[model samples]
Target: MPRLLGVDIPADRPTIISLTYLYGVGEKTARELCHKAGVNPQARARDLQEDEVARIAALLDKDYTVEGQLRRQVSQNISRLRDIASYRGMRHRRGLPVRGQRTKTNARTRKGPKKTVAGKKGVKDLR
Candidate 1:
């Protein structure tokens, strides 16, 4: 197992893809990190020694605000939205569409499942 940013990468995957398991690192960032660390993109995590994993982790820690810092920043952004009472915040409060999307017929994803009205049962004499 290769550990980076305190998260372990499964030895089964290639080194490039495995690094994406980190909080802020994605495919592009992973590739960049691999390039920076002098690690082969096709290399497997299991093939790497602890020092190599440490190097990548150190690189990320030195250069980026991930881990705890990112979480705090994201939380602060959400808090700002809530504090402002803006349209987006109002939409959040109401559970309605927020991003200027037409909700007349669409936006079923955020609105959740539609409720079907019950039809009249069979009636005699058209009553």
Candidate 2:
């Protein structure tokens, strides 16, 4: 594995693909990084030379917000929303879907497992 910005990129994968393992880096950004760093996008990460790795790292540090920086930025945005009491922030704070997904069904991922209420069947039986 090639360590870039404190994250180990998979050595067996193409450099462009491996770059996606870094947070905030996707296919397009990876391609752009390769172009700017003069690194071969198709080259496996393990085959990269020290200078090439340094170039990539330097470019990332200078031009991109990634890894921990990106994570903190996103969390800060969410917290700002929460502080302002936005609807989306409320949803996030309540652990509910924030994208207007129907909660009538198929929201178990956010709502967690069902908490079934008892006594309905017993009331019907008594009647």
Candidate 3:
């Protein structure tokens, strides 16, 4: 594994794919980083020279927000929303779907497992 910006990238993968192992880096950004760093995107990560790794790391530090920095920035944004009492912030605070997804069904991912309430007894139970 090649360590870049404190993250270990898989050595078996192509440089482009390896770069995506970092938080906030996707295919498009990885491609762009390879281009700007003058590194071969198709080259295996293990084959990259020290200079090439330094170049990519320098470029990321200078031009991108990623990893812990990106995570903190996102959390700050959500916290700000919550502080301001925004609807989206409320959803985040409440752990509900924030993108207007209907909660009537299929929101199990956000809503978590069902908390079933006991059913009411029928009229026959009263007799």
Best by TM-score: 2
Q: lDDT tens string, model 1, 50-70?
A: 778878888998987776778
- List lDDT for all candidates, in order: 0.83, 0.94, 0.94
lDDT of candidate 1 at residue 65, scale 0 to 100: 75
lDDT of 3 at 94: 83
Better of 1 and 3 by lDDT: 3
RMSD (Cα, Å) for all candidates, in order, is 5.1, 2.8, 3.2
Candidate 2 ranges with C-alpha deviation above 4 Å: 111-127
* Shift in Å, residue 48, candidate 1: 1.0
Rank order (by lDDT, best first)? 3, 2, 1
Measured with C-alpha atoms, the lDDT of residue 25 in candidate 1 is 79
Q: Any runs in candidate 3 off by more than 4 Å, and if so which?
A: 113-127
TM-score of 1: 0.72
lDDT of 3 by residue, 1-127 (tens): 7898799999999999999999999999999999999999999999999999999999999999999899999999999999999999999988899999999889999878876657854547555
Q: Provide the lowest-lDDT 10-residue window in model 2.
A: 118-127
What ranking of all candidate models by TM-score puts the best one first?
2, 3, 1
- Provide the TM-score for each candidate, comma-separated: 0.72, 0.86, 0.83
Collision count of model 1: 0
